[model samples]
Target: MQKLRHSSLAIAFSLLFSLAVQAAERPNIVVIMVDDLGFSDLGCFGGEINTPNIDSLASGGLRFTSFYNCARCCPTRAALLTGLYPHQVGLMRNGNSLTRNGVTIAEALGAAGYQTAMSGKWHLSRTQALPDHQKQLDWLNHQSQPDRTFSPVDSYPINRGFQRHFGPIWGVVNYFDPFSLVDGETPVDEVPDDFYMTDAITQKSVEYIREMSKSEAPFFLYVAHTAPHWPLHAKPEDIAKYKETYRDGWHKLRNDRYQRQVEMGLIDPNTYPKPELQGQGDDWGALDEATRKHMSQLMSVHAAMVDCVDQGVGQIIDTLKETGELENTLILVLADNGASPERYLQPGFDRPNETRAGKPIQYEGLFTPGSETTWGYIGSYWASAGNTPFRYWKAQSFEGGAHTPMIAHWPAGLKTKPGSTTDQPGHVIDVLPTFLELAAAEYPQTFKQNKITPVEGLSLAPILSGQQRAGHPALFFEHEGGKAMIADGWKLVQPKQNGQWELYHLAQDRTETNNLAATEPERLAQMKRQWQAWFNRVKP
Candidate 1:
């Protein structure tokens, strides 16, 4: 009896040790994705924006210079959550639900004994915009539609494996009182007067993190911030910080950001000479005083929104530190798409006629921007500058539309030297696989009685380990007729649907200036075939 008791005690101790080691190996991954952010918007990415918290991630971790997104909001979100291309997951364009067939990172991780929570924009679900424009605006303004359901009940984040979710279901929202805000399945009917979407999203994320830390199981928290995406709304205090920053205008500002990129070794001038001011002849010197002042104010609002996101990042980091999960938690900060050129000149559907307090939301005549009663956008000229040294803006296949800044910080598992940078390309789809690998989770062939498409992303673990792992032989991209393929340092892009194709040796010219299609016909044709084949394969 005594011998048997000693044997049982030894086995129990060994089992507990194994479980503890497994838990330590699995990291708590927190993916923070911002909306319509430019490639060089963050200080770590060579912009003047005050993003010290995100910069700290770049400072203490690694930065990827060639990371890519789907070039739009909903598609990028779908790609990141599932390890599949946007099309494969039924989000080829906006206003679509993430297919049940696509397995989310949360679902995969949760099955592997991990806690899953999300806070912020859950634009994965289809937004039900009323056809009647006024009614839609009323719904968007939260004025008339008290019981409006933005999306299907089963499609919300909580229904898709996230135990806790707090965010808006629609893509565009009035930050002050978002149209489709919800707490899990229940609609958030009222918000405090001082409510700011960025701050609220961060608060809920902090709450989820603190609550989950009590449990032994690792957690996955996706902070999908809807900041810096337009209607150009921002708090006055935050806007004041950058009121005069863009007074120099987009031209000088673009040059300054590019020079900073060159200084930081993120860009090589000779190889990637700044593409000529993309919104050609955007000469700030020639603009009228009023126009110039308005432009600067618009950017200040955009910058202010980003600054608020950084503040949120600080809070998140503080929460992690407080829970003693800082070292073991893997934190990733990136954007959904490139800077938007969406100038809402005509306040149509989803644009409110009045604020929550009955003030008309102004977009014409005379009104200061970044306020609850004003509507504005950081137009293409500014966006061209926003996506500095790159061509085009959001919703295109050009580098500017798809390129994003990605920072990875994992003190316990990351082997890369601090403040180091990598030129290796990574796509949003890779995010799900990276998390799956880190959590020791498997991507299921069938999930919850639905058949899942095979994940189309390579794990970025090898890159984090400081190893030269194989990159995707051919990464494919397509959204609303725009398309691109980046393969082995070569990129082929088509800005317009059914437009002419342009090719470039990305290693030599990432700016897409010198079209090699005229010089390298055979290569261009082959790439066209490859992209077409991929498009066909992904077509649902």
Candidate 2:
């Protein structure tokens, strides 16, 4: 009897050790995605912006120089979440809902024993089943609708595998008292007087982290921040930091960012020749004094918004340390798309003319921008500067629109030199696969009684581990009518739908300054065929 008891005790001890090993191997995931952020926006990415928290992560981990996005908000989010092309998930355009054809990362990770949670903007679905025009009409009619009654509950984050969620259901909202605020399935009708969306998102994210730290199951937290995008709303002190920072104008700012990027080794000065301004906008020096002041204030607000996001990052990092989860957590920070040049003079339903507190606002005429009652945009000039050496702006297939900065930090998992940059071309679609690889989760052939599309992205695990590996054979992107394809250092791009194809040898001219379309006819033709084939295969 003593011998038998000894054998049983040994077996029990072995099982406990195995379980502990598995738990340690599975690292927690925290993905932070910012909306409409540019390539050179972060301090680590060669921008002058004060982003010490984000920079610290880059300093201690890996930064990807050639990371790509879908060049638009909704499509990028869809690709990042589903690990499939946007069209494959039935997200060909804005307002399109995520179809059952694709499985979300949250669903896959949750099935693999992860506690999934999400906070901030979810632009994957329209609030109502009605046509988009009708939805817009409804929004105009009921500006102060507390609950988004029209939004399908099934489309909310709670039904989409997130165990907990806190954020606005719609794409855009007032920074103070946002519309369609939800906590799981319940709508939060009222907000505190001191509420700011960026700060609120951080609070909820920290709360979730603290709660999940007590559990044995590893967690996946997606913090999607809608900052530095539109309406130009920010706190007074934050905005004050950069009141006249843009006095030198966009031309000089662009040059300055480019120089910084080269000095930081983020870009090769020889390979990436400075690109000419392509978008139609006023030259900085040509603008009147009043217009310059207005533009400067708009940029100040934009910078302030980004500063708030960095502050939130600091809070989150502090929470992870307090919970003793910092060392084992894999943190990734990226942008949904590039900087936006969208401008508005007066507010429409989509762009509210009044503050959350019912204060009337104006975008035109003489009025200080960046206040709760004010609404404005950075316009094309500053947007080009925001993109730095890249050309064009959001909603296009140009490098300026698609290229974004991606940072990865995992002290326990990744084995690479800190502050190093990887030029291995990667896309937003790869995010889901990377998470699954790290968590040891399997991508299901079918999920929830529905057939799911196979993941189109390759796992970035090997690259993160400092291993030399071949990347995707070819990457394709299309939005509205703009399309582009990159394969074997050759890039084929078209500025508009049915537009003439332009070719560039990316290894030589990543900036797209010298077009080789006429010179490399055969290469352009072959790439064009590839792009069309991909479009046919994935189009919804």
Candidate 3:
């Protein structure tokens, strides 16, 4: 009897060891998404922002030049997490949950025995204000709301396959005392005096990385930052660095970024001559002295916010290095969308009117921008420069609206030429698919008894191996009536307010400067038909 028992124990030990070996062989993965960052805003991608950590990642990995987002925050996030078209995942126009029909990357990887955690924005949940205005204000100010329930419990990140979640549940937030700030399902009402939203997101991410490093199983960390977005909130020290830099005006900013892009071999200057801003003015010289100074201060605040995010990226890199997870860890850095062009006049909807100290927020009559007591925006002039070479800003289908710089870095596993950039067009939807490929996780036909939506994005693994995979046959886009279709190096775009369909041979024109709607009649009609077919199938 003793001999038989020993044999059975030996068999069990062998099986457990096999499982452990399999788990350790898998690489750790991290996805960092920043909000409202421009296509050329990062130092690695032609901007002057100090992003040494992210730039180092690019230096040791590869950059995707034609990466795209869904042209809005929530939509892009939904697509990125689920690997499905945003419309098919209950976020066609936002204010909805990431439907059960789609499985998140966390869910898939978690099922594959990988530990998962997310630290930052979780704007996939419903974000509508209550009918009671006082209650809404109370909740926004973090003064009240005895009830802990702000969003649907099922849709919260804690329940959405993240073993732990720490961040805001809503899209809009105040930097100091952010609305919808939560730790798992519990509300984080009070904060320290020096709490900055960007810094908090980074700290939590670093904390999670260290904690997860203790586990044997490889982990997945999603660090979604709400930096460089509206309200222009940033710290004073971060703002001071860029105050003098942006006073050169938007015209010079745009020209400088574009010139750097060409000189760095990021883009071919042959077909890509510096293009004019779409539906916005580029004449920064026209502003009066007061307006110019105010505008410069606003952009400085925006740059500071971006700089803070980069600092967080640096911290994350250091944490990874310290934890001995720098190698064999895949890190992807990309923006949620292009720079926002919206302006603010007052606190409306979720925007707060008073600080926690009962100070009235200032907007019309300029107060110091980036303070919790004031509201400010970079406006279209600065936004146009931010998007550089691309035509339109956020919420539009033009290149400026959807295009983003994507860096893929895996120190131990990288196979591509270091510091090289690829023109391979990729979308946020491809993110989940790439993670799945990396983790060797399977996408289920049904998750939690719900028939899951099929992934619309292709894997980018082939590109990482220094080879081209068969990319998308066509890329279709639509957000708030801004429409575009790209196929066979051809593009058809209709700006929301413009009300006209224009065609461009992207390989030739590159900037949509010369319209070919009248000349390429047959090709235009075919593309329109293709786009109409795609819309018909995917419309929400």
> Deviation in angstroms for 457 in model 1?
0.7
Report the error of model 3 at residue 185, Å.
Answer: 0.6
Scored by CA lDDT, what does every candidate get? 0.87, 0.85, 0.86
TM-score for candidate 3, residues paired by index: 0.94
| Model 1 spans > 4 angstroms off | 1-23, 146-148, 280-283
Candidate 3 lDDT tens digits, 1-540? 865664455445434433543565788999999899988889988899888888999999999998989899989999999998888989899778888989999999999999999999999988777777877776676667745477887899999999999999988888988988899998887889999999999999999999999999899999999888887899889999987988878888889999999989988877786787543544666767787788889988998998899899999999999999999899999988889898767665678888888888787655568888887888787887899888878988988899988999987666788999899888988888877777777899999899998899877766776655567879999888999999989999988897799999899877678889999999999999999999889876
The positional error of residue 338 in candidate 3, measured at the CA in angstroms, is 0.5
Candidate 1 at residue 74, lDDT? 90
TM-score, per-candidate, Cα-based: 0.94, 0.93, 0.94
Candidate 1, residue 489: lDDT: 85
Give per-residue lDDT, candidate 2, residue 460: 77
Better model by TM-score, 1 or 2? 1
**Clash pairs detected, candidate 2:** none
Q: Count the backbone clashes (under 3 Å) in each candidate.
A: 0, 0, 0
Using lDDT as the measure, name the better of candidate 2 and candidate 3.
3
